[model samples]
Target: MSSTPANPPTALHEVWLIRHGETQWSLSGQHTGSTDIALTDHGRAQARALAPRLATQSFDAVWSSPMARAIETCELAGLGGQRVIVQDLHEWDYGIYEGRTTPEIRASVPGWSVWDSPVPKGESLLQIQARAEAVVARLLAASGRVAIFSHAHFLRALAGCWMGGAAALGAHLYLDTASISLLGFDHESRAIRRWNS
Candidate 1:
């Protein structure tokens, strides 16, 4: 029996990745991982700004990292009632690098980068990738539009994984605070619809 070349690619759900707004550590360029910090005043304003943009679309589900920053952003973005906390969405565990800036880390090890360098006593890139992949799997299984509010590094990792790339690919995805990104299928292939908006 002959069959059509592979069936047409199934349309995938759309995912909106939202990076939490500005925080003291975010502004200061600190690692800010696993620190559970809150958003700054301007950060709150930034989150409020998201409400209008997000209101344009209706999401089937809204997810947030357990961190205060992500939770607050989700709430301020007018999704608090629908926000579901996902631990896997939390920021990378910086460990020894926690609260340290890239410049500070590079002072000792020149050109050190989180994507390539080892995170001593902390989650490795592989570990972060696993979490990201897990979350991606869940999103793929779900229907309709989904929104996630999380930290920068983790969200970048998730984006990379969503595109079937390694976590290190996040090195090239420059995410700004309070930015929104969209991920969905491009015809038959997984693609980034819009990014860093």
Candidate 2:
């Protein structure tokens, strides 16, 4: 009788990409893009708490946004040793909308979607989405689990890139600081597996 290889049950590796904990802007619903900002005291505590959780999993690679908030989270989570800085993973540059609430933007733009409307002086969604796809392609070529710490908007965009296309969909994925999310293979293909989870 011919035999088929048994299902591996799981990929040999898994990536646990965690969005950095909340910043002042996050708590207030402001668009925090490339701006360099520090974590609030509560944000620091959240990062600290992530330490134990991180210790439980061993990653082949640990990466963080060059941004202070993300790097700080990685360090506080006890993952500072092998951290690699990935510029492509930085948050979406909110440009003129930086630190502003959606309602405020709507007040001026009238039905403008961040996904559709271009933020003055910032990279467009296409640019951000392309960067994300590159990162995912790199990861897929690598041979082990990884840990990535990053910001909200970009991470959401990255999630979209991971799924295939249309980074605009990232606008829908809500992530919590210090929260863990997973991406892995399902049936010989890439699948979200879990999100903002």
Top candidate by lDDT: 1
Error of 1 at 61 (Å): 0.5
Against the hidden reference, what TM-scores do the models get?
Answer: 0.93, 0.90
The clash count of every prediction, one per candidate, is: 0, 0
Query: Model 2: runs farther than 4 Å from truth?
Result: 1-12
Name the lDDT of candidate 1: 0.88
Task: Identify the candidate with maximal TM-score.
Answer: 1
What lDDT score goes with residue 152 in model 2?
Answer: 74
Q: Which stretches of candidate 1 lie over 4 Å from their true place?
A: 1-11
* Number of clashes found in candidate 1: 0
TM-score of candidate 1 on Cα atoms, chains taken together: 0.93
Candidate 2 clashes between residue pairs 3 or more apart in a chain or in different chains: none
RMSD, every candidate, angstroms: 3.8, 4.6
